[model samples]
Target: MIGDRLKMLRKEKGLTMKEIGEIIGVSDAAWTKYEKNRAEPSIESLIKIADYFQVSLDFLLGRTNIREPQFVEEANIQSEFLKEFEWSKIGDPSQMYFLVENLSTSIRKYNEHKVTELELQLLLKTISDVVLYFNTLAELKEKYKSITKEVLTEHRKTLSQIIEDLNNILEEAYKDILDGKK
Candidate 1:
């Protein structure tokens, strides 16, 4: 099941086992063994693989088919929100504009497809939460802009940590797509 999911996820990302191996600092043959279920990764290696693939360890271990632990639509919204927020942090005005446009389009598509009210509520709530969080970050950025260089450096470090967290979330979303949950 693990190998099957790994292979499925690799293809879904339009990546090959070799590409994944490179990301995890493993050889293609070693990755092939992973996909073939001929060898299991060590626990640490498994975590690295999960981190590289953006999937939960549970999913990697075949504990659940639901790689994202959230509804499919909500997962997509979260993924898109994270992507937009990350881009915005990098000072990309176009990315911010596209993020809003994409959210609008997503809502319209959901309505056109007759998505359930509950699902719509969940997606909207998720988006709202993300927006509020970004707003808080924006407020902090404004407040910190005039701080001393040392403080600014620390703030930058915090932002980097935030980006790392977002990357992990994105990896999990990628895993979701691989598991056919998105």
Candidate 2:
């Protein structure tokens, strides 16, 4: 799906693969593979392409049909799982908490040359707001097995109003750090 979207966007702009690759600081072959879906781009490269095309990442990924970037739903969790959901010790929520907890540790290590800035940023956005919502839902599901669909729908709306995407979260975190709020 990404390959198809990438090819379409590239053609629409009348740019050759090589030209776009040069613009994005990637090799022509690498760009070709991306279009062919033979190779997966790194998250940074994905972000770069999304920004370059002025298209939302979800559109490129075929997760949504919309093209506007800001309106992109970074993640969508169906209120109902395909199968019966079960709580796990290594669930997404726990992993998200682990990631947040280790953020400071990563920064300390990076200052001491243990990790790179790339690693630090990746760690920070590892769990997007959508993921946080899903994990919260999962926790609630564990406790309220009989919750009605209406309640879940209302909860989704409430969460969406408050939580922003991982990108925004990173931006806020950076602001907090710079403003001595971290």
Q: What is the lDDT of residue 62 in candidate 1?
A: 90
lDDT of each: 0.71, 0.72
TM-scores across all candidates? 0.39, 0.41
Q: List the residue pairs that clash in candidate 1.
A: 54-171, 54-172
| Collision count of model 1 | 2
Q: Pick the candidate with the highest TM-score.
A: 2
lDDT of 1 by residue, 1-182 (tens): 78887888788889877888887878899889988999877787788877767777778889766675344446567669767778667776666768767867767867787544445555565566566666766776777775567555666765665565556545544665878888
